[model samples]
Target chain A: MSAAVPSMPGTRRFALLRHGRLLTGAILTGALVAVALLSLLWTPEVPTRLRILAKLKPPLSEGLLGTDQLGRDILSLLMVGTANSLSIAVAAVVLGAATGTLIGIVAAMRRGALDALLMRMMDAVFAFPPILSAMMLSALLGSGRLNATVAIGLFTVPVFARLARADTKRILRRDYILAARGAGKNAARIAVDHVLPNIAGAILVQVTIQLGLAILTESGLGFLGLSISPPAPSLGRMLADAQTYLTLAPWMALAPGITIALIVAGFNLLGDGLRDRLDVRRDVSA
Target chain B: MSPLLDIRGLSKRHPPRGFGRGAGVLALDDISLTVEAGSIHGLVGESGSGKSTLARIVMGFDRPDSGTVLLGGVDVQSASGEALTKVRRQMQMVFQDPGGSLDPRQRIWKTVAEPMGLLEPRLARLQRREKVDALLASVGLQPADGDRFPHEFSGGQRQRIAIARALSTNASLIIADEPTSALDLIVQAQVLNLLMDLQETRGLAILFISHDLAVVAALADTVSILHRGRIVETGRTGEVFARPQSAVTAALLEQDAVSLASTDQLKEKIHYPR
Candidate 1:
């Protein structure tokens, strides 16, 4: 866009927009979040208020994506659904990663019996499939977005904690870390200041990838009637509702299904591109 | 002042675990030395000759199995948190691998200011910055160079930054463990000159550890030649180089006596890989 910065031999920097997949993914993610936020402020139809007048109207004259069986504009429902779904996923991931990273750092720094115990506990948690774990928790807490968020968040914690612990353990052995210890820095300061910054890039890449998985998991719960309950405009629930009317109104299922696929694909692509960008081996010149 | 650093019976042996347990590798065997204040004492040896180990012991990083390292007569063997901090503040080390020694994520300024932050917490943030800038300038780097990361600098520049960091704290003793090994010959000379200048102006005692005889010859006032973890020879740098008593020392200077000493089995190649 302007003057080119001198790059190391063989390391070429790409513009953010040049990486089409990542750019597309980021744009889609942002749009989804914006729509979701807007849904909170206003929606064309009260997602639950059933009105027979506009029922099952097909695209164009009836407006975009037409109307569902409940006469809710499919476009409007999508806006609300994207917001509701992403918010829950984001909240769960934030909570999970924050708590998990703390546990991981503590385990890495303290080590010994406590570290072994915590690692084993994390392993036990990891053994459970994310969906199955979320299902059980949702069943226990009853079907709701909050329950889904909590279940997903708890599940996500062990994943990040294990990653953080492994990375932190390796970083602690580095010469600078030893220097910090020699300099009389306490374990906490060393862990927070030195250890955390080094491993944060890898952790962040993991977080982004996990975020995609989180969205899919939350939607799956909704599809299974274990999240956000009925009447809420969730893409998963929409797909479930459209199942009975597949032959009659295929677009009902198609729109939301496509949204889910795109969102997940975008996240995966973004994560992949970022991993490439942040790669220490990949020099910044060519 | 009773020698700035005194060592007595400093022996460290790595237990050859697995199959080699019975074959004890005496990394440092009864290595004792005294470093007078305001003197540049060089510990010269071949690789695996225990020069690095001695530096490590002096810094309190490794405890000798049965030895005493005294920093101004205070035994470092049992120094705890506060005492160790105090000892470290009084004595600092500059490592061989500047890239490895520094936190890559940290800026040059942060690395330089770290020791000061640990030792002199009472100094205000602005004062610390001023001191760090001064230290950087003193090491031939401009004040603005502190803003750059370690990866941004060349090998020689990084070594200089490491030296600046070591000098930032008011350390009486600086153990430079092959501080210029990664640099090119010219840069190495430049760094050596800087060290000499610093020693001359600051009156700082330096323990310059290196396997390079030529480099050591350039800087060390007194040289201690270690072999198999023992100080085989110790004297003025010039005297040791001119008339090496041991064949191991002679071979180290690339003299023809290397093969002659092999007959005794005690004059094994020092095995110092560059």
Candidate 2:
């Protein structure tokens, strides 16, 4: 029960280390989002308008990044593609994390038969990989951004469920939780007031990491021609289109490819940094 | 007048783990005790003596196999939903670990006001804050101390915060399970004195559970000595301490005497840095 007072100097140094990673990740992630938002206002040329005369122009030509096989500006396509990819990733992560966390909390609180059932069902969902599930849904629902989002989001349900369930179970065992119950607080009230607030740090770290994974999943589906149909300028679809013209136009493939990698890295770094900062026990030991 | 808290013929057995067919270990054996209004009934025993099991049952946290717990003559064991909650609000617990009892992430005021928030959901936030401040003051803590977290306080301060929380509901009965076992000797004395003061001022009935015979002897009026899920002896604290009938009670009193003598010697030799 004795509270361990962490040394201020040690904690301040650790904070600096964690902040370094967070800052880098934030900057990279911010720049990509800014590009995507800016694309909503203006791009060098219309992303889908094909000018046959300027086909396959290299970098620093008619547009900043050049033109694609159809003469649609590569820079414009990259920007618009980022917006599409980001929107899908954000929606999928939000949907998956929110629903999954709710299920997890319920499962942990109503432990025993209900807990076993919910967890087993989540295991069933976990069996299917994100891209495979997205492809199957795309086949049934037909290829579109909405279908892609649902598939990727559903795929992430088990991840959040497992994390949320474990964290909730741990919090449920804490003395304060028992005290809360003893104070006449019901299960639902305790779940909201006590359980959720304590586990939120872990859940947030999971969400950031999942955002990166969702983006990757959507892009993989698009690469396989099962996500966000052609002419709308998705990052994955652009990569797929560039496959045939790789030798003739490498930038067509490289532009979207590098952008996807940077964004994913950004999210991952941010998640790691957050996990370190928020969990004081881990922070002190490390 | 009926006792403020009454427990009768309560028995609980944990179901055998795994796929076994045998009966489980009996945690409590028809345990019965009562706390009269404005008095302290101490349940003293060694570890695994069913002290905590009885406490949990009295709080309605665990269901008893055979007995009924009556709070103000209401059968708490039979109550459900809102009825259970209503009965629960009349009785609260002060847990063993003071530091762990209060939420580390929450401010002292929020932790103190949590019970009131649950029981009186319609109370204004400002009003609740004022009430929490008053509760802190009652527990010998400054009103401004409510703004800090549990980690910012010493072990004794955290226990005071917990005592404030227990009093938040204006509960008639407070079940304190070894409330000061975790503190240093000086802090332990302070917390015990505070509990005694609160009991006198609030007319609060207390079920004080502990393994330490000396501490319980000092605070509790009536003492029940439990051994291996059964009450070995029960009587007024002074009579039992002076003339222990059961071997378990005699051994506990002897051990406590030895520990007290040794602690006195140690205290003289050791000076703890403040």
Candidate 3:
């Protein structure tokens, strides 16, 4: 057999071309992040303050992007709304992915009764939609962004658990894991050193997709009056508030609606791109 | 001296499916073998002949229904936690598929040095790298090649990396389960020669399990022929090869002759470097 050779120059170039969609997704996600970060320090007008005379003013009039039904600045609300939605989505995704992946790894490592129990628990969670759970949680815990985040995060646990469990099981079957076991590495070491790294790519892709779902769920809860209370700007609440003034102030609904769509689309594209790049089988074939 | 690995009256049966109405199939039946330190004990058997089952039981990966596995004088089945880890540190295994044996995502250095990290745990990163380089060199792989991933190397090179990993802990006994079965005939010989060199230098006891009798004939000192979970014959390599005892042995020898002849023809067609 021949000595080790470096990967082909063409292969590197092909990888870049293959992940072009990832670059586009990153750009989209980055722009939204920038808007959210920009909102933290400054906005043209106060999001919550009312100016009665400027109610339902057209875009570029009394305030940029005009005023809403409460005569609150649409531009400011949209900026702050972006921040709120992004933060909640990030928190939920982190919470769900971390806990769910741990559960999944445990299930995969200890098969039989534990595996069945964890999966059944996930199935039970799967029975109720995220929105339904969020509504129940909102009623029980009192309506706010924290409760909404917790509810949505809990909903994503089962998804992450199933994905992590399947990926871990596949990795456990590899001979390297057997070799590690033979090498005197215990279950925890095997999981951390071997199983986790191999399955991280799959989990990462799932995380991005779950972020999109979390954002969507958060907005749905807000629209239904089960999310963050009024006076604080929320994209979904803004959409709900603007529904009555469809003719007089269509921009009110248009701004938040378009923002939610863009954020979700960005995350979905990013997730798809990550799946393509992280697919080990594709790398093996290449 | 006591054997490096000793199995006595080892038997394992898989439970029958469908509410366990029927009797379970015996994977290994009353099997017993011993590998002396610094000697190679070849376990030869065809597929479904329990060679792998024997390897797994000896490695403590699976428990036997009835028998004891003593590795380096420690009972493998009875040991637990830190004791089991200590016992395992004295033994390592080379799997059948070299490609699947090493993690594709890990660099050669990390893969080679993994056992050392697990067993010793206190070795500094630099020291581990030095040991990894030395291990790679011992396996005839360039020290610089340790930076590359497993996929970047040829099958033989990967197998060498696997060997390097197995040798990391400086184990007294190595269970090589068909280690050379995946490579070309010429490469297979090179790997076998490498194993022999390691065995001689380190005085390693090797349990070489393989389906090919010809391959075992080259390296094994004491040979055990298995058929359908039972040992058909056990003797010195020369005696087993020279004599005709069991029908299973005769059939296996005849099969090896046919395959060896075909291999010789193939070796001639393609000019392989010695």
Candidate 4:
């Protein structure tokens, strides 16, 4: 039950399959994940191999999508970059959501002094500008995707915590929760049977939104040379390397730029669509 | 045996708003009552007459400032662990708003089976399922109806589901706090009739709380009239109405006179506009 509601499984799937926003988002995000997973198998050419003679050769002149300033295949680099970008986002969001949701549930259940202290701490965490702190965090931790993911994950804590805690508190006041208690279920039992299920929809929506944010933030770090060094490739790093060439080679930025835009938009659409579906059902039941 | 349920010297004060300074409102003032086994004890009161506060205290959802609630000779206020569980199992409750009481997210069977699940954990899963079906049937609902959600039911059906849940644990006493207040006239009579039937069949006791004297007068064996936070008059239903000693009781009788027929009003000194 989501406080006491069971998971909305198959019912939403077929109905939502016909939805434009959800379909487009599913296709785009699905493509992103598929491309990332596909990277393990193949790419057009060796992404790290530098063809000195083919440097700045532009699209279609040689390999498809042409080459970067270093003469590496842009298509291959983009293919590998999806894996790098997605892994960082997924890992960071999962870590943050799990930790933050637990803290939020605890804060709500405990209430009083502990709740005040926990919520105030979350407020403090929220006050810190996410991008700047993530920048400093990755920079201090040295170079690597883990450093950036960890940094982004840490900052995401407050958002999920606030969401979970607020939802739990609201659902706790419901007569069913009281009825559950009267039925001989303890505080923890009600939390598992009622609180978690009811708060889940909100949490799921937040997680989707945060996945997009994490990707954006981690890319920002990579743009600053904080993640995915050398041949590993990163979309943000590709954009960074392309910026210098600018007028000389505008096509260098196109591939990575378009990919990032599509992925972020995909996540936003999916989150919004899920929220709409949840709202409609809630109104019906209400 | 002592009464199935008993409350002695129960008191509660709702603290004032904002920093909680100054004197608080006395929601219940040293109230005491008893519900004999297989009898209906109606708590009659106006809107602010501490009916809900006393219900909460007796249900052990909220602690009384000073009092002891004995359910079958066990002190509910201080019972803990297994004793607490037993107290919870023996004394079940039905709320005013059936919609609010049943979890909209849960299926009817699960809600009805919850108390049984807790109290009879050792019973086989299949046996529990059978029990749930039996409980649903006992409430005049089809067993298949148990698969549906609360949103799928009418107000009367929801109240029936709530009653089914109360009966699931084989509770000796059901604290029905305004169980019919949210229902329409016909449905209220049906649910009251259902309660009377359940008490008849199971030999259970009921602490029926309500704001309407006519409703109480029709069902309760014993009645207590509460005003503000104190019980102004109480006795066998017939005796109390025959001679109301308190002005508050007189007012309740007068207010409830609207529902009574012209003939009955002559003896009670009440007149109904035809």
- DockQ scores of the candidates: 0.30, 0.42, 0.44, 0.36
Model 2 per-residue lDDT tens digits across residues A1-286: 2246558778889788789888888888899999999999999898999999999999997788888888999999999999999999999999999999999999998999999999999999999988888878877999898999999999888899999999889877777887898877789989888888888899999999999988898889889878787889999989988999999999999999999999999999888888887887521100
- Please tell me which model should have the higher TM-score, number 1 or number 2: 2
Candidate 4 global lDDT = 0.84
Ranking by DockQ: 3, 2, 4, 1
Off by over 4 Å in 1: A1-18, A281-286, B15-24, B255-274
- Chain B vs. true chain B: TM-score per candidate: 0.89, 0.92, 0.92, 0.93
Question: Can you tell me which runs of candidate 4 are displaced by over 4 Å?
Answer: A1-18, A281-286, B260-274
Between 2 and 4, whose TM-score is larger?
A: 2
Clashing pairs in 1: A11-A284, A11-A285, A11-A286, A12-A285, A36-A83, B47-B272
What's chain A's TM-score in each predicted model?
0.88, 0.92, 0.92, 0.90
**Model 3, B154-177: lDDT tens per residue?**
878888999999999899999999
Model 2 segments more than 4 A misplaced: A1-15, A282-286, B81-86, B117-119, B262-274
For A11-73, candidate 1 gives per-residue lDDT tens digits of 434553447656777887777777788889987766676667988878764657887787778
Q: Give every collision pair in model 3.
A: none
Highest-lDDT candidate = 3
Candidate 4 positional error at A136, Å: 4.0
Candidate 1 C-alpha lDDT tens digits along B1-274: 4999888989998888888749678999998888888888989877898888888788887788898999987888798767777887888888888777788788888888888765777889788889999999999999999898888888888888888888877788898999878786667767887887888778899999987776676677899989989999899988998898988788787753442343223112121111
